[model samples]
Target: MGPHIKGKIKKTLSSLAGQSAQSLFPDLFQNESAKAESSTVIVPPPPDMNWLAHADFGEQQKRADSAPPALLALGGKPQQELIAQKLARMGYVVTTASSTAQALERLSANKYRLVFCGADAAFEEVLRFVNRLTTDQRRHIYFVLVGADLHTFYDLEALALSANLVINTRDLPSLELILIKGLRDYEQLFRPLLDILGSTP
Candidate 1:
């Protein structure tokens, strides 16, 4: 090709390359003023989960402090009266039920911290009810099984029965002392766990 023609062709090619570059990447050709006028992205901060947890814990603590702990005594009239008197002495608001159906109805109506079921009085059904409770609900209740044959304060028997304590019917006279001892042991075992979970009983 002639020198003049070659020079013209090269100039035309350079002009086309610059136009193609501008079309492919328009941002690259933007003026400094235009770039400065673009909007800035603003991100919202994350939610404060710790604050929510603390608020929930505070509300539970207030409710616990305001109410007397509730106790459900299920069995014969004589035994129920004895349990009621003994637990009331310890500041519990005791409710009595003569049968398993009555006991289940009471349980559904209110949240009881303590539950004493006579082993000879529909104990199996009550035990099943306790067993089927949610983990959160089960941990909050202190279940006691009272029977003529149960060994009082026997850890193995209590564990087998899924009860917090097992009390002999003969020891109903000492129900106060036995319940105090059982509560102390229960607190020692569960306080740390409840603290870790940030739950109140």
Candidate 2:
């Protein structure tokens, strides 16, 4: 099998093994014996393959999959830094920009799954940025506008803009839950294509 297919098979097997272990022994993950066994288990790569190509492809995939989302803090430095730290602790990578221009530059050069814009940013500027993205690009990204109050933010007609989500900065304590929901929604949106890919011969 090709390296891509091999990797997929390995992932599938690993997932199945995890599920089986969890069902058979509810505390398997928390057991010291299971942890020790897992630590010692290592599988060698298949022979007669281009190891370099496989390694490179794996590295590229890791970088792409684990890349951080971009954050436009504008004038909210302290708030943005706190949010970034929280997200990092939760296993999310975040890139913070001090200004809308800087955020736009980063967005132009990279593909981010999520983008958070601070309410301090001009509503018109945020709208323009969202409008610039193509329909397909917009589909892949969740644009969020964060503010102190949704009422004031939406009253400015910014609700008519192309943001996928609107978050109140006051609700920063629940930011993790919001992020989890957003990710789940995004996954559900693309699940059909993922199912087709997994089933392909």
Candidate 3:
């Protein structure tokens, strides 16, 4: 309360801090005040209890599901650009690739929440491509094949093999509207491609 008592309290605290560092960090405290000049916060490891674990899990799921994730477009087309920009406006981060080779390079470097590939990029290429990526730790990119020329441009087997959705480049708005309503509703049109990307293992 008074100056003398305040000084005594400060002194006691200083001594206690020194003793704490000496006990916890040991020889690292050889410099004492030099290291002591740094302030620290002690956050102990979380308890192994399930309630604490559940709380953390709930927090993480809340964060992940709340925000729109990044998107990658693996083909160079005006439609892809327009669609990606539209998605970006809707709060998704978008990156585009001009070809399968470029897409491969981009895939190596970044993890996208979704991928929209030009439908013509060969089924084997997409399959072999994604197959190579599966062993990597963070391979959660959802693949969607994009093109309106499905009759002439679609690869049924390849679309079935690697993509999660087969979206007509022209149907971007309809797809978004459909997705807002329910992902299951749009799964019919997009299923062959969507299944490959959505399936685990």
Candidate 4:
């Protein structure tokens, strides 16, 4: 509290410095300071991981580009799933859209070789979307309308509806065969046009 006591304390602390009592005042002792510095755990910087993510993305993109062409199956869940399964088994990537808006969005975002509109779908809206597509855009897609009132493979009805094929819902059990036959005819009918346009699916 007084100058004399303070001087005594400073002298005692100075004496304890660099001595075995250095442990009592590490900041005042050079050995303790060096020891404290040496004992500090130095953490290494993290490794660069951005390249790994970029590499994975690139691989996935490559696989998607090289994979089979995609098709859209628009309908109720049951019909959409059944059609998707059949198309997938036939070596095509099938995307399902439960509503007209969803189907339109999918069509606008991606190129689909085929579009199967089910009886439950909003036919007028889907047809309007297809009708609005430019010739160049429309030519690449094979549109099919599936409904109970439609006759399977009815060229006249298909023409009226601007569809490549029309299938009766009752004939859905044989969809795979019908699709094979219809797609064969479609390719034969459009190969020349597609070739001229410089785009073939």
Candidate 5:
């Protein structure tokens, strides 16, 4: 081929290769934008006492001397009373449920930040309640699976679509901690979006 023809062929191949590369790795291109968005963390200044720095994780579990604050409570079996009282001492608003039907009704009527379910409760009942919860575009609540295994339900994506994390009440901060940290990571990753929310508020 002539030199001019060869140069034109090479440019065409380069263009094709560039398009293929982008198709194979769209995230690499988007990551710069993600990093830029994630860099804007601006948490409110900690108390001047620097209490958080000296705070001990073990101390956090210490039974609060004061009544626990309630976020929101789900109604469930009598056994759930244990879950209710536990959260009450931690400062969550405890809602009680004797059955799954009652629990779903409460969710429709109120906004609950955390949901604790009994081991005996029907899984479909819980999933349905969660599905209803997701319809609210305004609130993003965290849900704990409470004693069920991932194996019990293979639909991890479906569960997570409604819940930020799932936990076994028996496990100490295992799934719950993961959920909390995941949320913090999300908040960190979307700090710019948060800034916009705050500004508009």
Candidate 6:
């Protein structure tokens, strides 16, 4: 072949090799081009109030304002905080107490629809408190006993006799459901009295 034709053949082969390389490593070529284009492009920073501006702050505040108060009479700080947070997430305004005495003080000072007492508190003290409240005919308050293992702490039969409800701490995920069921039970128990009151002048 002539020298000019030979050069043309070589150029054609080089062009074909470039196309083959691009086909074999398409991602590599695309990524390099993308990087180059991105380097020259200007991406504006996200707005500072993006989430806050779009959030339903008014509804959240209204719900917070309307949540009912509940008492968490637990023993350890960690467990108390954990239980309190869980209840708060369920929309209850939770107040935490480390001891039975503190819890009783809070109960006397403020009304609470629900009381969650941990086994860490003296069981006898909790029982006596519950008994006193029952004697006073204050059935509006629903009592629950929190324990890591219910059987480990109290005799199942005795506990069933004393406590309104028993919960295992390990089952924290079900805490909201337990609270709802307890509340429903309390409402059902008092439905007759509510009906009587409604019937009265």
Candidate achieving the largest TM-score = 1
RMSD of each predicted structure: 19.7, 22.7, 19.9, 24.5, 11.5, 20.0
TM-score for each model: 0.64, 0.54, 0.47, 0.62, 0.47, 0.55
Q: Sort every candidate by TM-score, greatest first.
A: 1, 4, 6, 2, 5, 3
Question: Quick one: best lDDT, which candidate?
Answer: 1
lDDT by residue for model 4 (36-74), tens = 788988544333323322332323222222335555545
Question: Cα deviation of 190 in candidate 6 (Å)?
Answer: 3.3
Predict model 2's lDDT versus the native.
0.61
Error of 1 at 19 (Å): 91
Candidate 3 segments exceeding 4 Å error: 1-71, 122-127, 135-139, 151-159, 178-201
What lDDT tens digits, residue by residue, belong to model 6 across residues 50-99? 33334333334323324778888775556677778777876888888777
lDDT of 6 at 57: 33
Q: In candidate 4, which residue pairs get closer than 3 Å at backbone N, Cα or C atoms, i.e. clash?
A: none
lDDT of 5 by residue, 27-95 (tens): 886887688898997644312322323434464443432442223233443436665555655555666
Q: Quantify all predictions' global Cα lDDT against the true fold.
A: 0.74, 0.61, 0.53, 0.71, 0.50, 0.63
Which sequence of candidate numbers ranks them by lDDT, best first?
1, 4, 6, 2, 3, 5
User: Can you write out model 2's per-residue Cα lDDT over 23-56, one digit (the tens) per residue?
Assistant: 7677755687767777885544323223223332
Candidate 1, residue 30: how far the Cα is off, in Å: 87
Off by over 4 Å in 4: 1-73, 119-121
Please provide, for model 1 over 87-195, each residue's C-alpha lDDT reduced to its tens digit, 9 standing for 90 to 100: 7766677777767888888887888888888776465787888899999999989899888888777777788889999887777876766666577778899899999
lDDT of 5: 0.50
- Give the per-residue lDDT digits (tens) of candidate 3, residues 1-201: 899999999998887874665687777867776666765665444222232222223222222233455544445567866676666655566677666767777767766666666666442365466666644332455556666653212335334545555655555544444233223333444566546777431
